[model samples]
Target: MEVKMIGISKSFGTNKVLEGVDFELRSGEIHALMGENGAGKSTLMNILTGLHKRDAGKIYIDGTEHYFKNAKEAEEFGVTFIHQEMNTFSNMTVLENMYLNRELKTKLGLLDNKKMAAEAKKIFNELHISLNLEAQVDTLSVGQQQMLEIAKSLMTNGKVLIMDEPTAALSETEIDNLFTIIRGLKNNGVAIVYISHRMEEIFALCDRITVMRDGISVSTHQISEVNVNQIVRDMVGRDIGDFYPEKTTPIGAIKFEVKNLTSTGLFENVSFSVREGEILGFSGLMGSGRTEIMRGIFGIDRYDSGEIRLNGEQITIRKPSDAIKKGIGFLTENRKDEGLILDFSLEDNIVLPSVDEFSKRGLLEQKTIDEFVALLLKRLVVKAENKDVPASSLSGGNQQKVVLAKWIGIGPQVLILDEPTRGVDVGAKREIYLLMNELAQRGVAILMISSDLPEVMSVSDRIIVVREGQLAGEVLKSEATQEKIMNLATGGN
Candidate 1:
C-alpha cells in the first residue's frame, strides 16, 4: 500500500486547488497532512482517492503507476477516505450503513443481513465502540456517529485510510479510544493519511508529517524532526505570534442572563449570565447538553421553562427572527447546514440576517448590500476571490469567517459561538480569537461553547463546566487549569 504522488496539480474553473504537490504514504505508518483551510490538503487527498481528476500528476502505488476512476474504485483497491463531514445515511440503521453498496449475498442472491450485522458488530467490538446496530444513525449523537463512521471505514479492511478531522465531534474518552484503534491499524500494516488542524494530535499521534500551503507542498519531515512552530510557519508562511491573543477587554455589568432554562429530557434548570465585554466559556464532554443549551437560548429549540433577559430587561424570543430583532446573534456549531447556504453566493449568506436593513421600499439595494458584504469580508480577513462566489467555494476556516461576518453585520450586543474553532487551522484560529477580543472590547457579550480545554481556558474570561445537562462548576481564567476543567467536566471532586 505504498503511494507516491508527484507534481500533482488540479484546477476548477481557473481556481488552482493543488499545484506541484508531492506526498508519500508508506505501509504501517501514520502520515499527517497539515495545512490551513484551502491550502489543498483535502484536495490533494481527493486527487489520491480519485474523487477529483488530477490535471497534472504521477501516482505510483506499490511500484505500479495507477489512477482510480472513482472513490468506489479506490475503496475496492483498499483505500478508504473518511471525510470530516460524515457520509452516513441518517435514515438507515447502523448495520445497514456499514454494509451499504457492499452488502453480502447468500447463494440464492438474497441479502445477508445476519452476516453483515455480525461483521459490523465485530468491528465495533474491536474499536471498543458500544452501539446498537439496529438503531437509526440520526438517533445517535454526533460523537457516536463519528465513531460509527470510523467503524464503517474499518469494515472495508482498508490498507490505506484517509481520515479528515476524525475527532472533531468526539469527546476526550472517545478520542482516546479512537487513537487506540488507529494505533492498532498501523500495527497491522495499514497506512493512515491523517488530516487534522489540531496540532497536539499531529505531534502526539502521527509518525511523519507533510505540510501544504497555497496549493503546494511546503515541506515534509519525520514527526520527530519538526515541532509545532515549524509546522505552523510552513502552513501559514508566517510566524503568527501567539496562538491565543491576550484578553485585554474590560468586563462590564451583566448584559445577558438566562434563568431556569430547561428543555425536557435535554437540559434542566440551567442558569448562566454573561456581562458586557465578557467571554463566558461553556466546557463539557460531548452530549453534555452544551450545544442544546445554546440552541434553546438562540430560539432554535424550545425550552420548557426559561427566562432570558437582556440589558436588565427580560425579552421573549419565540423564534430566531425575534432574537435577531432583540440584538442577538448565533453562530451554530454545524456551520455548513445552519450558518451558511452552500449554493448561495458569499454576499447572499453574509447579508441574509441583515438583509432588511439594506433594503428600501420592498426592494433590495444592491449598492448597499455590496458595500456591507465587502466591509465585513475585509474585516474578517476572509480569503475569497469574489463576493459573488458561492460559499461552498471557500474553505472551512473561510466559511466560518463568512458565518462570523454575517453575525457581525447584525452588530448584536449578545453573541453565542459554539465550537467556533472546530476544524479550523492554527493561523485562522488566532485570527478568530483576535476578532473576539475586538468584539469584547466593543462591549459585546459572547457565550462560547468549546470542547478544546486549552482554548476554553485561554479565550474565555471565565469558564463554567457542564455535566449531563447541569452546571457542574465555574472557574476564572486566572485559576483555571486543564486538570481543574476536566475534573469539573467529568464530575470529579
Candidate 2:
C-alpha cells in the first residue's frame, strides 16, 4: 500500500500552519518526518489522519483519491495515528482500553473477555511488553501507559501507521524494544511514518526523510543522501554548531543547599548544594529518586526531615506557593501533566505564578500583564502566532519554551529543571542549553536532573549520581565520564 498527500495546505484562522506540503509513504518503509517545533509537521499529519480538515489538498491511497470524514474513516482506509499524548481510558482495565471501539463479541451479545485477553497477550508477547491486564490504566506508570498506546495502534494492523514521538516518554531499554517492533512491522509491509526529535533515532531507523520549515515542504530525500547538518540547516535555516554551550561562568559561593532531605520511601538523606553561576546535574536510572529529591527541595512533595537553606538563612517551604515566593523555581519532568496547564494560553501560563504582581488588590493592570508576557515570549522565542491560543495547540518544543518562560518570570535564586528537554527538538534543545548558559552567567544557580548521559556530562559543572533513593556519589564535570557516572549510579563504587 502507498499513501501520498499532494499540495496539502491548512490554516487555523489567519495562522497558516501547512502550505502546499507534500508527504508520501510506501509499504515496507519507515518515513521519518523531521522538523523544528511549529514547522507544520503535526498539522500535516493531522490532516492525513482526518482529525483536521485541510484547506486544500489531495490524499491518494494506492494511487486513488479518497476523502475521509473522521479518524475512524481514515483508520478504515488503513491509516492510523498514534498521537504523542497517550489516548486511553484511565478508569478501565488495560485489556478493556486496548479493545475499545472495536470490541470483539460473541453471538450471545456479551463482551468476550477470554478472547480479548488472549489477543492482547499475544500482542504484548510480540512486542516484548509486560503489564498486568487486570490492572486499571491509571495504575500504570507513564512508560507503561505509552507502551499500551503503541500496542493499541498495532492491534489496528493498519497499512499506514503514523507515530508521533512514540518514544517520548520511554526509557532507553523500552526504546530498543519499540525499535524491534517497528522493524518487524516494516518487514511485514506496513508503511510507517515515524516522527521524532532524536537525531540518533532518525539515523538508525528511517529510510527516507522529509523536512518542513515555516509551513512549507522544504525537501524530501533518501536518508542515505543527507547528513544531520543538512537536515538541521533545512529545518532551522542555520548551522546549530555545538549543541552545548561552554560553561565559562565561574562558580561562586553556595547559593542553595538541601541538608539531609528525606522523603520516606521516595528518597532519603539526599544532600546537595548548588553554587551561584553553576549547572549541577543529578544523574540516575529512571526509578532512582532523582526527580523526587528535587520535588522535595521545591516542596511539591513534603520531606519527612530536612532543612532548605539559601545563602545562610534556613527557609520553610510547605507548598509550591511557598517555594515560588522563596525564589525557588521548578520545571517539572512531566510537562504536559504537571508543568504547564494545557487549557491556559502561553501568555497566561508565563504570568500565572506572578498574578499578584500585576493585580493591585482587586484590580488587574492589563497593560502591565501584556508587557510582561510580550517581553518573555520574545526573550524565550516561544514561536507561536497568537499568545492567546491554548498551550495545547503549540508543538512540544514550543510548549517547553513556554514552561521555561514561566519559571524565568519568577526571577528565582535557584531553578530546578527535571528532564528539561525531554520531548523537544534538537534545535530547541540547543536553544535551551544556550539559555541555561545565559542564566548561569547571570548568577542564577541551576540544578538539572537528566537521564541523557551525554547532556549531563556536557552541560553540568558538577554531576551527582543517585541510586536506590540515596545520594550515591558526586563528580566534577572535568572528571566525569559516561562509564564513571554509570558505575556510580549502579553502585559500582
Candidate 3:
C-alpha cells in the first residue's frame, strides 16, 4: 500500500495549525512524524483518520483518491488508528472491547463469545502481552489497556496503521514487545505511521522521519541521516544542551514524612521521607499503588490509617484544600482531567492555586495577578501570544507548565509530581527537569513518581519501588539500575 497526503491545510477558528503540509508513507515501512507539542501532529493524524476534516488536501491510497467520512471508512480501506488517548469501553471485558464494532457472530446471528475470546488470546500471545481476556478493561493496568488498544487496531485487518505515542505508558519490556510486533507487521507489508517523542525509539524503529514545525512540513530524512540532537533542533528550532539539567543544591533535613500509611486495598504500610532540596523517585509497575500513595498523601483519596508530618509538625489533612494549606502540592497523573481547566485562560490556570494570594479581601487584584502571570511565563519560557488565550489553545508541554506553575505559585514545601514528563516532547521534558532542580534548590521537597526508568534513574537522588500495593525496596541513586529496579518491582530479592 502507498499513502500520500498532499497540500493538507487545517485550522481551528482563527489559528492556522497546519499549512499546506505534504507527506507520504510506503508499504512495508515505518515512517515517524516528529514535532513539538501542538505542532499539528495530532490534528494531522485526526484528519487522516477522518475524525477531523482537512480544509484543503488530497489523500491517495494505492494510486486512487480516497475520502474518509469517518473512522469506519478508513478502517474499511485497511487504515487503522490507535490514538494517544485510550478509546476503549472501560466497563466491557477485554475481548468485548477488542471486538466491539466487528464481533464474531454465530450462524444464528448471535455473538460468538468463544471465538472472540480465542482470537483475543491468540492476538495477545502474538504481541507478547499478558492480559486476561475476561477481565473488565478498567481492571487492567494503564500499560495493559494500551496493549489492548493496539490489539484492537490490529484486529481491523488494516494494511496501514497510525500509532500515536503508543508506547508512552509502556515499560521497557513492553516497548520491546511492541517493536517485535511492528517488525512482524513490516514483514507482512503493512505501512505504519508512528508519532513519538522518544528519539532513540524513532532511530531504532523507523525507516524515515518527517519533521513538522508550526504547522508546516520542515523536512523528511532517512533515520540513518539524523541524530537525536539534530532532530530536536528541527522540531523545536533550538538546541537543548542538556536533557536533564543539573541540580546544585545541598540536601537538607527531612521536610515531609509519611508513616504507616494504609488506604484499604489501594496501598498499605507506605512510609517514606523526602528532604528539602531532594528529588525522591517512586518507581513501580502500573497499578502498583504509586499514584494511590500520592493521592492519599495529598488528601485526594481518603486513607484509613497514616500520619503525615511536615517539617516535624504533624498535620491532619482531610481534604485537598487542607493539604494545600499545609504547603503540600500534587500534580495528578491525568493532566487533562485534574491539571487544567481547558476553558480557562492560561493566566487563570496558573493562578488557580494561588488565587487567594492575589486577592484583595474577597475580590481579585487584577494587576497583581497580571504581574505574577508575566513572571511565571518568563520563568517557565511559556510561548504564547497572550495570557488571555485559553489553556486549551496552548501545547501539551505548555499546559503541563501551567500545571507546574499553579502548584509552585502556591509556595509549597513539598511537591508530588506523578509522571511529570508523560506525553511531553523532548525539549519540554528538559525544561520540566530544570524546573524540578530549581524547585529543589529553593528548599522544596520533591517526590517524583514515574514509570520511565531512565528518567527515574537520572533525576532522582533516591529511588523507592512499590509492588502489589506494598513497599518493595529502596535504592540510592548510585545503585538504581534497570535490572535492580525491575527485580524489586517484580518481587525478586
Candidate 4:
C-alpha cells in the first residue's frame, strides 16, 4: 500500500496548480503534507485521488504504474479520501448517509436495512463514536457531522486513507478518540496521508512530512528531523517571526455587550461584553452553543430574549442587513455558505458589505469599488491573479482573507469572528492575527470563537468559557491556563 507520485504537473487554463511535485507514502505510516494556502497541497491530493487529471505525472502504487479514472475508482481500489469539507446528505438519516451508493441487498434485490444498521453500528462502536443513526444530518452539529464523515470513511476499510484537516471540527475528546483510531489503523498496516495546517497535530500524529510551496514540493523530512520553525520556513520560504504578534492596543470602555441573551433551546442567559480595542476569545467544546449565540447576535437567528448594545446604547438587529447598518460585521465559521458567495468575483465579494458606500445618487460607482477592492486585496495579501477571479478559485486560507477583507471594507465597530483561523496555514494565520491587532488599535471590538486552544490563549486579551449553552467562566489572559479553561468548559470547577 505504498504510493509514489513524481513529476506531477497540473494546470487549469493559464493557472498552474502543481508543477513537478513529488510525494511518497509508505505503508503503516502517517505522512504529513504541509503547505501555505494555494501552495498546491490540495491540488496534489486531488490529482492523486483522480478528482483532477494531472497533465504530466507518474503515479506508482506498490511499484505499479497506475492512475484512477475517478474518485470512486480510487476508493474501490482501496484509497479513501476524507475531504476537509464534510460530504453528507443533510436530508438523509445518518445511517442512510453512511451506506449511500454501497448498500447491501437481499436475495430478492431488496435493501437490507438490518445488515446496514449492524455494519454501521460495528464501525461506530470500534471508532468510539456516539451518533444517532436515525437523526437527519442537518439536525446534527458541525462536529457531529465531521465525526460521522470519519466513521463512514473507516467503514470503507481502505488500505490508504487520506485525511484532510480531519480534526478541524472535533472537540478535544473526539480528537483524542480519532487519534487512537488512526493509530490502530496504522498498526493494522493502513497507510495514511495526513494533511493539516495545524503544526501541533502534524508533529504529534505524523511520521514523515513533505513541505510544498508555489506548485512544487520543497522538502520532505522525517518528523524527528524537522522543527516547526524549519517546516514553516520551508513552506512559506521566509521567516515570519512570531506565530502570534504582541498586542499594543489600549482597551477602552464596553463597545459591544450581550445582556441576558436567551434562545429557546440553544443558549440561556448568556451575557458578555467586549471593550473597544479588545480581542475577546470565546472558548467552548464544539456544539456548546457558541456559534448559535453569535448567530443570534448577528440577526441570522432569532433569540427569544436578548439585549444587544453598542456604545452603551441598546439596538435592535432583526436581520443581517440591520446588523450591518448598525456597524456590526460577522465572519461565520461556515465560510463557504455564509461568509462569501462562491461564484462571485473576489472584488464583488469584498465590496458586498460596502455596496452603498460605493454608490452615488442611486448609481453604482465602478471605479470607486475597483479601487477599494484592489486596496483590500493588497492589504490582506490575498493570493489571486486579480480581483476579478471568482471567490471559489482561491484556496481556503485566501478565501478566509477575502471574507475578512469584506468586513474590513465596512469599517465595523464590532466584528464577530467564528473559527477565524480554522483551516488557515501558519503564514496566513500570522497575517490575520496582525490584522486583528491593527483593527483593535483602531478601536474595533472583536469576538473570536475558536476551537484551537493554543490560538485562543495566545491571541485573546480575555477569554470566556461556554458549556452546555451557558457562560461557564471568564479569565484574563494573564491568569488563564489551558487546564483552567477546559475545567470551566467541562464543568470540572
Candidate 5:
C-alpha cells in the first residue's frame, strides 16, 4: 500500500498550521515525521486521518484518491492513528478496550466474550506482551497501557499506521519491545507514519525522514544519507550543539526532607532529602514508584505515614493547597492536562496561583497583574505575540516556560518537577536547564524525577535509584554512571 498527501493546507482562525505540505508513506517502510512543536506535524496527520478538513489538498491511497468524510471513513480505508495522549478507559479491561467499538458478536448480536478475549490474546502474543486480558487498564503501568494502545490500533489490520510520540511514556525495555512490534508490522508490509521528538529513535527505526518547519514541508531524506545533526538542523533551522546544558553547582544545607514516607501498596519507607541550591534526581524504571512518591510529596496523592520537614520544621500537608501555602510547587509530567489552563491567556495563567496576592480588600488590581505578568513573561523568554494569547496557542516549549512562570510568580521555595523535558526540543531543553541553574543559584531546592538517565546524571548534584517502592542506592553526580544507575535500580549493588 502507498499513501500520499499532497498540497495540504489548513488553518485555524488566524493561525496557519499547514501550508502546501506534502508527505508520503510506502508499504513496508517506517517513515519518521520530525519537527519542532507547532510545526504542522499534527495538523498534517489530522488532515490525512480525516479529523480535520484541508483547505486545499489531495490524498491518495494505493493510486486512488480518497475523500474521507470522517475518521471512520479513513479507518475503513485501512488507516489508523495512535494519538500522543493514551485513549483508554481506566475502568475497562484490556480486552474491552481493544474491542471497544467493534466487538465480536454472535448471530443474535450478543457479545462474544470468549472470541474477543482470544483475539486480544493473539495480538498480545504476536507482540510478545505478557499482560492479562482481564486486567483493568488502571491497574496497568504506563508502559503496559502504551502496549495496549498499539495492540488496539492493529485490530483492523491497518495498512497505514500513524503513531504520534508513541514512546514518550515508555522505558528503554518497553521501547525495545515496541520497536520489535513495529519491525514485525513492517515485515507484514504495514506502512507506518511515526512522529517523534526523539532523534535517536528516528535514526534507529525510520528508513526515511520528513522534516517540517513553520507550516511547510522542509525536506525528506533517506536515513543512510543523513544524520541526526542534519535532521535537527532542518527541523529547527540551526545546529543544536549540546543536547543538555552543563550543571555546575555547590550543594548547600538540607532544605527539604522526606523521612520514612510510606504509601500503602504504592511506595514504602522512601527517604530522601534535597539541599538548597541543588538538584536531587530520583531515577527508576517505569513503575518503580518514583512518580508516586513525588505525587505524595506534592499532596496530589496521600501517604499513610511520613514526615515532611522544611528548614528543620515539620509541616503537615493533606492537600495540594496546603503544599502551595507552604511554598512548594509541582510541575506535573502531563503539562497539557495538569499544569496549565489551556483556554486561559498567558497573563491569566501566570498569576493564577497567586491571584489572591493581586487582590485588594474588595477589588482586583490590574496594574499589579500587568506588572508581574510583563516582568515574568519577558523574564522567562516566553515566545508569544502578546500576553493575551491562550496557552494552547503557544508551542510546547513556550507553554512549559509559562508553567515555570506560574510557579516562579508564586515564589516557591521547593519545586518538584516530574519529567520536565519529556517532549521539549533541544533549544527549549537548554533554556529550561539554564533556568534550573538560575533557580539553584538563587537558593531554590529542586527534586527532579526523570527517566532520561543521562539527563538526570548530567543535571543532578546527587542521584538516588528507586526499585520497587524502596530506595535502592544513592550516588554523587561525579560518581554516577548509566551502568551503575541501572544496576542499582534493578536491585543490584
Candidate 6:
C-alpha cells in the first residue's frame, strides 16, 4: 500500500492552519509527523479522517485518487486513525468498544456476543494487552484505554494506520509491547503514520520523518539522515535547550500534610506531606491510587479516615467547594469532563473559579472580568484570537492552559495537578514545567500525579510511590530513580 497527500490546505475562519502540506507513506514503512503545539498535527489528521474538510488537497491510495466523505468512507478505503484523545464509550464493555461500528452478527442478524468477545480477546493478546474483554471500558486505566483505541484501528484490517501519540500515557513496558505490535504490522505490509513528541520513539520506530511547522511541511528525511536536535529545531522553529526547566526554589517547611488517609477501595492509608516551595510527585502504576490520592486531598472524593493539616492547622474538608474555600485548587485528570466547559468561551472558563471576585453588588462587571482574563491570558500564554472564542476551538495544549488559568485565578495555597501534561506537545510541556516551578517559588505547595516517569523525575523535589492503595516508598529528589520507583509500584519490595 502507498499513500500520498499533496498540496493539502485547510483553514478555520481566518486562520490558515495547514498550507499546501505534502507527504507520502509507503507500504511496510513507518512515517513520523513531528510538529509543535497548535502546528496543525491534529487538524491535518482530522482532515484525513474526514472529520473536517481540506480546502485544497489531493489524496492517493495505491496509485488511485481517493475521497473520504466521513470516517466510514475512510474505513471503506482501509484508512484508520487512532486519535490522541480517548474516544471510547465509557458505558460500554471492552469488547463492545472494540467492535462498536462493526459488530459481529449471527445468522439471524442478532449481535454475536461470544464471537465479539473471543475476537476482542484475540486482538488484545496479539497486542500483548492484558485487559478483560468483559470489563467496562471506564474501569480500564488511561494507558489501557489508549491501547483499546489502537485495537479498534487494527480491527479495520486497514493497510494504512494513523497513530497520534499512541504511547503518550503508557509505561516503558507497555511501550515495548506497542512497538512489537507495530513491527508485526509493518512485517504484514501495513503503512503506518506515527505522530509522537518523544524523539527517541520516532528515531527508533520510524523509517522516515516529516516535519511540520506553522502548518507547512518543512522537510522530510530518512531516520539515518537526521538527529534529535535537528528534528526539535525543525518542529518548533527554535533551539530547545532543556526540555525540563531547572528548579529555582529551595524546599521549605511542610505546608500541606495528609495522615492516614483511606478512601476504601479507591485508596488506603496514604500519607504524605509537601513543603512550601516544593514539587511533590505521586508515582505509581495505573490504578495504583495516584489520582485517587489527589482526589482525596482536593475533597473530590470522600475519605473514610484521614487528617489534613495546612500550615500547621488542621482543616476539615467535606467537599470540593470546601477545599477551594480553604485555598486548595485541583486540575482534574479528565480535562474534558471536569476541567473546562467546552461550549463556553475561553474567558468564561478562565473566570469560572473566581467569578464571584469580579461581581459588584450582585451584578457582573464586564470590565473587571476582561481585565482579569487579560492578565491570565498573558501569564499562561493562551493562544487565541479573542477571549470570546469557545474553549473547544483551542488545541489540546491550549485547553490545558485554560484549566491551569482557571485554578490559578483563585490563588490557592495548595495546587494539585493530575496528569497535567498528558496530551500536550514538547514545547508546551516545557512551559508547564516552568509554571509549576514559578508557582512553587511563590510559596505554593504543589502536588502532581503523573504516569510519565521522566516528567515526574525531572519536575519533582520529592517523590511518593503508591501501590495497591498504599504508600510503597518515598524518595528525595536526588534519590528517585526509574528502577526504584517501578520496584515499589509493582510490589518488588
Please list the residue runs of candidate 6 whose C-alpha ends up more than 4 Å from where it truly belongs after superposition: none
Backbone clash total for model 5 is 0
Q: In candidate 4, how many Å is residue 488 off? A: 0.5
Candidate 4 Cα errors over 4 Å, as ranges: none
- CA error at residue 75 for candidate 4, angstroms: 0.2
Candidate 6 per-residue lDDT, tens place, 269-360, comes to 77788899999998988778887788877777789998999999999998898898888999987787689999999999988878888898
lDDT of 2 by residue, 1-493 (tens): 8989999999888888988998888999999998988898878888888899999989998999977888998888788898877788889999989998989999999989899999999999988888899999976756678899999988887898989888866656678889999999999999999999877899999999999998998999899999999999998899988878777898899999988988889898878888999999988876688877888788777889988899879999989999899888999877888889999988889898888888887899999988889988887778887789999988888898999999989888899998888778878898899989888988899999887888889999999999989999999989999889989888899
List candidate 2 segments past 4 Å from native.
Answer: 489-493
Task: Kindly report which residue stretches of model 1 are placed more than 4 angstroms away from their true locations once superposed.
Answer: none
Instruction: Summarize candidate 3's per-residue lDDT along 238-315 as a digit string, tens digits.
Output: 887988777778999999999999999999999999999999999988778998899899988899998999999999
Better of 5 and 6 by TM-score: 6
Collision count of model 3? 0
Cα error of candidate 2 at position 410, Å? 0.6
TM-score to native of every candidate shown: 0.97, 0.93, 0.93, 0.98, 0.93, 0.96
Clashing pairs in 3: none
The worst-scoring run of ten residues by lDDT in candidate 6 lies at 422-431
lDDT of 3 at 136: 97
Candidate closest to the true structure, highest TM-score: 4
For model 5, residues 1-493, the per-residue Cα lDDT tens digits are: 8988999999888778889999989999999998877788877888888889999989998899987778888887898988776789989988889988898899999999989988888988877778898889987866678788998997888888999888877777778888998998999999999998887788899999999998899999999899878888898898877767676667789999999999999999988888999999989888899988988998889999989999989999988999989889998877776889999999998888889889899687999899999998887767677899999888765788888889888888999988887766666677788888889988899998888887899989899899999999999989999999999988899
| Per-residue lDDT of model 1, residues 1-493, tens digit only | 8999999999889788888999999999999999988898888888898999999989999989999999999999999999887788999998888888988999999999888888888888887888999999978877788899999898888999999999988878788889999999999999999999998899889999999999999999999999888989999998999899898988999999999999999999999899999999999998899988988888988898989999989999878999999989999888877899999999999989998998789999999899889999998878788999999888877899999999999999999999888888888899899999999999999999898888999999999999999899999999999999999889896
**Candidate 2 local accuracy as lDDT?**
0.88
Clashing pairs in 6: none
* Best-matching candidate per lDDT: 4
